[model samples]
Target chain A: MFRSLLFVPGNNPSMLQNADIFMSDAIIFDLEDSVNLDEKDNARNLVETYLLTTKELPKAVVLRINPVNSDLVDDDLKLLQTRKIDYLLLPKANKISLFVLDKILKKIENKIELKPTKVICLIEETKSVIDIYELAKHERVEALMLGAEDLTSELEINRTTEGKELLYSRSRIIYAAISNKLIPIDTPFTDIDNQDGLIQDCKNALNLGMKAKTAIHPSQLETINEIFSPSQKAIKWAEAVLKKAKELNKGAFQFEGKMIDRPVLEKAKKIIEKAKLFELM
Target chain B: MWQAGSKESNDCLITLKKSDKTKIKIDSIVGHLFHNQILNAVKDTLKSDNINNVEVLVEDKGALDYTIRARLKVAIKRMMKDV
Candidate 1:
């Protein structure tokens, strides 16, 4: 349901309240890289108060806490326990093996003193993408986010308009996320003003199996939502597939001269769900 | 110059006239509106039991009015605990 997760900087107060007006399914109140080290405490304090006191937010509110090893992370975790945030977003989470992930879950539990059932919004940098399958297998992970900026920085490769550089990473993320039954969210398009670029990038990611995308600016939210949602054509195709499958009455059928089977039907159902999400009838 | 004035407990002043004086002055009405919302959100602390005076100044960067508001809210929320 969280097709668009917008990043509203934790230190920016007006952005937080304004975020509520959007139709995005999730809001990432960033307290990590978006915040300066000197402002971490201030950002954390504000985020806590906003969630507690502000007008009711519409979507799932998630706090991207500082890294686990950072001194700031302790206070971030402590503060989350007192807030209405739905997820404790963990960043720089590269190389998350089974044992390491379990350790993080345990630390979060101890720090926040929450149950093990509490899940993590896991963002994967380069090293983490290398071990994606193992990380996603952990029960504590709720969603897998591609941290392209960090990964690109780590790999020392420039990200192009086409996002061809991160294709492997994107594929790995989808594999892991699908295996874990978790949503795979793509990174934001850095060029805020390039609407056409954003649209194409979103389509590419959606085509590659990203269930949702993160938006850096509010202006980008509308387009991301539009590009990912099932279009009229997609809805028609899904409906046609369902109808064709029903007519066949067999497990396997044919559509557009291609084989349609149980898996195809499932995909069609997902498309239908997306259409519903878009209110496209 | 940025002015700080409080009319009510929940309302406070937060001004940010461009610190960089080299920049040209803006007369656009829309520009002011962008910073105004930011100032109101950050300085007001709407959830406070008390509502009072408010003022704020913002140095614009050709940003939309909404961006101004969002940034200001974070600043005010950060300072809320101390207030």
Candidate 2:
């Protein structure tokens, strides 16, 4: 249900305090990359305290821990054992990483009597993109997030404004996620000031079947939410198709010179359902 | 001396020093209303950590119980590491 997941630096008190007020569907309190090596302990303590003490929370709370190979991963998991985190955004994720994380989570769940925190595998490395489907189908994985910036660096290519370099990886992730019934999250648009570019990027991702997108800044949430939600034109078409189907009361019929069948009707129903879910109906 | 946290809004800067007797000083924007609550947070954290002799100075900018406790915990850890 997340159209936008905003990353908030874990060590910033002001951002952590105001995380829930943002319009993003989820808050990703980032402990890796955003926090420096010296501030890792500080960030971990801050996030733990905030999550434990805050009475009100956003719809979803995701903690982006360091990679599985890092020493900080164990401490990060141990600290949040008693807290209510919805997802763990595992960076540099691969089959081995997922397996290791799954085992650790199982141990923590068994010991603390806590529910399993779903995982969102971050596909950034070239090796991961090659085995995206296996990572998506992992039992603990609920989503697959494309990390285009890291991927481009690994590919030894320059990422462009048009995102031509990311098309292959993006499509692979989307297909893998969709096949596994997991959410596919597009990468954040790096240029915050370029709203037009952001819109186009989101549209391209959506058209390719990405279910959601991550945002580095709060300002991008509005555009991402709007772009991902069911459009008014689609809703209207769905409603009309359903109305005609009801009137005709047949297995297949002609509507506006196009044949209407069960698949079309089901697609229309899904659109209407999504529109209702997003409160656009 | 060991310190953690910052002067940012909704955060508290905690400084710790080795001392013969435990002393906690709290300076907060919301001290007038939450002075005792802030004091309790410091005392509770110190007690839980079994810290008997340390000088704790909390410079708070409207931090909640959790922020104060967390800052204090980090400071205590740093102080203990040096010990």
Candidate 3:
């Protein structure tokens, strides 16, 4: 249901205060890259305090903590011990890091008598791309995100708006996410000023099976949400497919030269659910 | 005391230095309209944290009261953590 996740710098108090007003499906309070090294503690304190004091936040609140090897992950997880955060965005995620994080989360959950927090793994490095299948198998993994900025930097390649270089990686991410029933989230379009470029990028991601996208600026949220929402034509097609499948009561059938089966029905159901959630119905 | 917070645009950067004389000095730069509102909130947070002797300088960029309070609280907490 998270079509657009808006990232607000954790250290920016003004932005953090007005975070809920943005029209994003979720708000990510970022404590990693966007924050300065000296201000990590400051950002953590600010985010923790806000979560503790705020009466009611409008959308789901996700906290993007520092990387696993940064020696700050423990403190970041500690904030979740008492707070009611929706998800944890683990940057530079890998199999071992996810395993270690899962253990830590379990221990914290047991100690504090709290529910387990869902996690979104950020695949940022080439090495992580290799182990995505293994990483996605973890029980707590709810989504897989492609961090193209870091991946391109790690691979020592120039990034292009066409995204030809990331095709393989995007496909691998989609495969891992889908095979494991996790949501696939695309990377942010870095150029904030170019709306046309953003739309094209979103279309590319949509074709590759990404259900949601990340937003570095609030301005991109509307476009991302709109692009990811199910269209009226799509909803009607899905509804027709479901009705035809139910009427036939067959395992597989032909309709308009396309095969309809359990998998197609499942996909159609998800589309209808998303359309309803988007109020397209 | 130790300095904390950022001076980024639209953020309140609070620099707190410990002082030997048991006195609290306040200085700030904010939008002309909410100057007093931010000032009172910062001073009240300092008192609540029992920060009696410190030099506080605030470089605010149109921040609200809660923001000012959050920044000052972090600065004070970092100072206390060091002590």
Candidate 4:
């Protein structure tokens, strides 16, 4: 149910204190790329302490830990064993990395009384894009996030504002995620100052069936949330369609000179459900 | 000598030095209101870790109890490594 997931550097006390205050649905306490090697231990300790002591938290608390192969992964998993984390965003995720992480999570679950943390697999490499369906089917994977910056670098192409280069990968990811009934999160728009660009980017992702989006800065949350939310017109149409169906009491009917069948009715029902979940109704 | 944390707002810089007896000094922006609480945070962390015979200097910028404890824990671990 995360329309917007904001990234917060794990070691910054100022940001950590206000993590839940932002309007974003979830906060990703980043312990990977945002943290330097020298400050890895400091970030881990800081995030752990924050989680343990903070009584009020955001709707969802996600931790983007170091890569699965890194030595820091062991310490990163320790948080799951002791603290309350909702999701683990695995960077540079692949089959081997997911296998290793699943095994580790299993071990932790056996030793503790805690529920297993959900996983969000970051799709950045070509191999990952190719194997996305399999990755999406993983029992622990709840979402699939497209990391455009890293994926572009791997492809040796400059990512343009038009995002033509990412169309194929984005489509594949969206399809796989939807087919598996998982949430597909779009990459963050890096240009913090360009509100117009952010709006267009969010629209493009939404049109392609992306359910959620990531935000590098808090400023982008408003636009992302607005674009991804079910529009007022759509909600009204859905409500009208449901009313007509109830009145007709028929499998197939005519509404506004268009054929309304079971599939269309189901789609209308889904829109109303989304509107209610997002508090738009 | 070992140190952890930073001088940023809502954070504290902790410095540790080997000594004959344990001593703690706190210099914080919110010292007037939370001086004893800050001292207890440091003492409780040290006691829980079974650390003694060290000098701790906390330069705090309104850090909370958990933050102070985290910084002190890292400082203790680094200091013990050299000992």
Point to the candidate with the largest TM-score: 4
Show pairs that collide, candidate 2: none
lDDT of 1 by residue, B4-78 (tens): 221222222334232333222232234545544544444444334232333335444443333333344544444
Q: Which tens-of-lDDT digit does each residue in A245-273 have in candidate 2? A: 99989999998899999999999998898
Could you tell which candidate, 1 or 3, scores higher by lDDT? Answer: 3
Q: Give one digit per residue, the lDDT tens place, for model 3 in A1-281.
A: 68999889888887788888998889989999998888888888788777877776847989998887778888888789546688999998998788888888889999998888899999999989999999889889899999999999988998788989999999999999999999999999999999999999999999999999999999998899989999888899999999999899999999889998899999899999999887889
> iRMS for all predictions?
10.4, 1.0, 2.1, 0.7
DockQ of each: 0.06, 0.76, 0.49, 0.76
Whole-model lDDT, candidate 2?
0.90
Candidate 2: regions farther than 4 A off:
B29-36
Docking class of predicted structure 1? incorrect
**For each candidate, what is the lDDT?**
0.69, 0.90, 0.85, 0.92
Question: Better model by lDDT, 3 or 4?
Answer: 4
lDDT of 4 by residue, A45-119 (tens): 888988998988888999998998989998988888545799999999889889999998889888886687799
Model 3 has an lDDT value of 0.85
Task: Rank candidates by lDDT, best first.
Answer: 4, 2, 3, 1
Q: In terms of lDDT, which candidate is stronger, 1 or 2?
A: 2
Model 4 TM-score on a 0 to 1 scale = 0.96
Q: Candidate 3: where is the Cα deviation over 4 Å?
A: A240-264, B7-9, B19-50, B55-59
- The digit string of per-residue lDDT tens for model 2 on B21-81 reads 9998999999999999999999999999999988999999998788889889888888888
Per-chain TM-score of candidate 1, chain B: 0.39
